[model samples]
Target: MRTADSAAEFQTAAQWQSWLSQGSTFPVFQPVLSLETQTVFGYECFGRLDLSENVASLGTFFRASDQTLNTLQQEVGFTLAQQVAQFFSPVKDARLIVNELPSHLTALTPLELPSTLEALQQAKFPLNRVVLDVLLEPGFQNPLRLKTVMERCHSLGCQVALGNLGSENSQLDLIPYLKPDFIKISLTLFHRSFRDRQFRRTLEQLGRLAENSGSALLIEGIETAEELQQALQLGARYVQGYYFSAPGRLPAPLPDFQKKLREALENFRMIRTKRIQRQVTWENEMLLRLVDISFVLFEADGLLRLNETDLEGLSGFIHRLYFSDLNGFQISGDYLLSETGCQIDYRDVGRNLSLRPYFFDHVYKLHGRPGGWSLSDVYCDENSRCLMRTFSRYVTPQAILYLDVLWANFADL
Candidate 1:
């Protein structure tokens, strides 16, 4: 509640030292959500205090005297971290990301803080689960020292996650090498521009990297459905914000609701995929025959021109694309006629058809290839219809194709 100018009273050397020695005033837990399971994953640690004497605002107080406050903040962070470690006891697997300025890691010599390390060890919590979330606000002065500190943290079993990832400059490059377990994007930047086009792209790129590097993306400061939706769409594996839940609740009996929900969702997903696979397998031979027939009737040059018989056969082939065991089917007579070498009287499957891509994406790309004959990861298509694809290659066009497979029997759902 105090500003930088009013923080002078609390900025004295003795008072500051006393506050640091006294440790954190209070701590708050902000929830983070899991993308795959849509459940509460973990909480980010934040300070909650009404410091009347020293600092007006937490941010300003923390930043006013950088040289001294940096070390104090680290101490504060470690104390709160230990508290969190104590809170999630027995099965302390959930991540606790504690914010610490880069200056803290560099300024406070680890050699001098034997008590801090000892306290953490005595806490009986594995260091790896306690993520020291380093914010890239003021940035780091020495990359080598930061890397060394990060390595030391890792050596001690603690993990590091780069927070406030907005710029794609030097800091972004350092993440791949550091190979942190998680990445946190600031909601301020993510929500700016209504929908951050560049940020979304960056999220996608980072998400891919995280996937390969075994890291997770946590979108922070999410307060609205629109932001949450956008973050999820961009492949953020985890989210931290007010939309899912806010910070304040004390550690209570968190029911195993998330576990049960995940199990149910996973079960349904498996069932859906299994059903699609059965149908795809059933149509395999028939669909293969259809492809062969289309190739034979059209020939190499036959694709350039179409006869009445060819059109009829193409129509039948397209029809077999659905009924023959494959999933997706588009009923576009006009577009199909113009695109393919043959003519067809079937109705337009529509240009924006969701199943249309799967129809081609799966079938042609998968023929005889390992795992290609099977249906895709059973996900709902754009049309709100359940669809999967079989990828295979055709000898005629010498290109891969997907057989859009659809399963409309949602009576079970």
Candidate 2:
């Protein structure tokens, strides 16, 4: 996987200009899909050359051209804007997202969006059906230019999207202010999020941010079925990749491509629903067990009168049992039963649990009301290094009961 950063100038500016002038190269489109509607949202434009039964990527060529052909958009992009006008219908056709050319991404020059829109207008392409994709490079320093470009797009009835997101060097801070209609993330980040916890957190936050900020999330480079599933899980409404349709000189592949998306969407929903059901059932089962244990604690009079010997009954199901007062200070010894049968530890009695989410969140949510069990987010248990969640409830007005359970014990079911 060679990156554009390391891309060497394979052709001079003069050579690319000569090749493009022959009018042999034209626009190719890869579709962007809306998973929710299960329909094609739009097509993303790329430059394509008809090479006698073989085709190569011209858009990628200019982007990875680095030092050379940086001005390709000035010539070739404008040419295809005219050609593209003829290919798509104004109403029936889905929108097209054009990548702002590599040269136009500079801080030194004015944004090319105004020029691109002017080209689209000159070509008679429908302004309402165009989406401009702006890539924010690692350290894109020109916010004013980008904001101005995006404003122009909206005013012209064209949408704007921030592209090439989720890469390590992608400029994320800009997404908030620009508030483009869409944010496009590469498939590379989808794969990384599965293995890396911190990356997964970032991905989750990105999803939330998109939802809150009214930007649709689009995942690109989905080459496989598995990648498509992950993108759906990431809550990406718009997706682009070879899985649904490949890039080609287009009249658009609507009939066949729509059929493919229909099947993919059907399969995704069935699988996703079953996964949700399984988790829901596990949660219900856990909640039932917690309730049963709560009954037992009440029988022991909120654990105040319960001795070490009294803790023996809850052996297998309950890992540890203790209580904290209204002020979040531990008030009761841990009561547990196991092969060791009946153990109580007061060493942590005065420990403060105030700052922990299991404490504060429970306090805040149930503050006025004070009844109801709450579960904490999963974390690794120091001793076992296994995933753990704290289950908490108010057993008495003064005492909040805490139970530690082996999360996998209930989860494996």
Candidate 3:
């Protein structure tokens, strides 16, 4: 509970020396609960200073102090499993989650058990009962070293987690390679993203990233019912916070049968159903509009022949409309809609688009399945930096038509 402002009291020369000595710290276990079952999935271990009322986290202090205390920090975590191993003897599926920092990984030998983990095992705690919450900062580390260390953890039968997802220190680039069993997003980062207009968009991306990595989302620091709901909405299966129980529980407690979980889950399901309904309606309306656009293009005879009058009822959401050949080469000018109204742009008339998945995949996929259109995943156009999706269909015998729609086109959820 000690604040960093008062940390000066512990920064004295003698206190710093005391920090290097043993018995200065011990482990506190915070429960990570599964919202679906409302049960304890695991308990994340923290290194807390063995001080009286104003006790502080050793992990927090060492991290902020830029000290070489990774070894001591990890010792506290392993002690949690050792000291509390008897508690989980009844809970066959319970795990003791621990931090394995970047420095720890770098110091480790390839495919070798970390010294603390080795000690934890000697205490009879199963490696499978350990979830190593790993981290990577924005700065680059030796990729080969990380790979070896990660493989070592996995090979030893431990579940590895990538922590700090969505935070400033989050290294999203390393996620695919690390292939963590869980992607841990802190509560602070998740709440900060709520204020962004693109929060939903970013959430979808995070979901996809977790999906592609075959990882479950583990969101922590959940302190309230609303926060739990938000974490659930973010697709987090495992969550931790004071709302369930604070850290330092000598023997981690059992599931307390929280009514809050049931209520949040029911609300989550209801809200999700309504959101899904809205998406279905949006898709149907947008598909109809695309068909109407195809009809307009047919009625106009050609791209250049189309004018502002041609976009009469469809200029609202359409960013641009163009025709491309089967091989994905644009054959016509764009009927682009602007704030000033629709205008024709011939700049990209002969542009090659064979490599563009939006164009080529649409044409190829719809080869036999005619009379239908394809809607692409929302993406940011690097040129304009606008969120866009391509709706493509064959409007002419020799060319396929594409309508670029802004992401704001009713995917409000």
lDDT of each: 0.55, 0.70, 0.71
Regions of candidate 2 where Cα sits further than 4 Å from its true position: 1-23, 50-54, 64-70, 89-91, 101-114, 193-202, 256-269, 292-360, 364-369, 377-387, 404-413
TM-score quality measure for candidate 1: 0.54
What are the per-residue Cα lDDT tens digits for candidate 2 across 219-238? 88888777777777778888
Model 1: runs farther than 4 Å from truth?
1-24, 51-59, 63-65, 78-93, 108-118, 167-170, 193-196, 253-413
Stronger candidate by TM-score (1 vs 2): 2
Q: Kindly list the per-residue Cα lDDT of model 3 for residues 156-232, writing each as its tens digit.
A: 78998888777675677777887889888755568875676576457657867998889888877788888888888
Q: Stretches of candidate 3 above 4 Å error? A: 1-15, 19-24, 62-92, 110-112, 186-188, 254-258, 289-308, 338-340, 354-357, 409-413
Distance from true position, residue 202, model 1, in Å? 2.8
Best by TM-score: 3
Count of backbone clashes for each model?
Answer: 39, 0, 0
TM-score for each model: 0.54, 0.77, 0.84
- Sort the predicted structures by lDDT, highest score first: 3, 2, 1
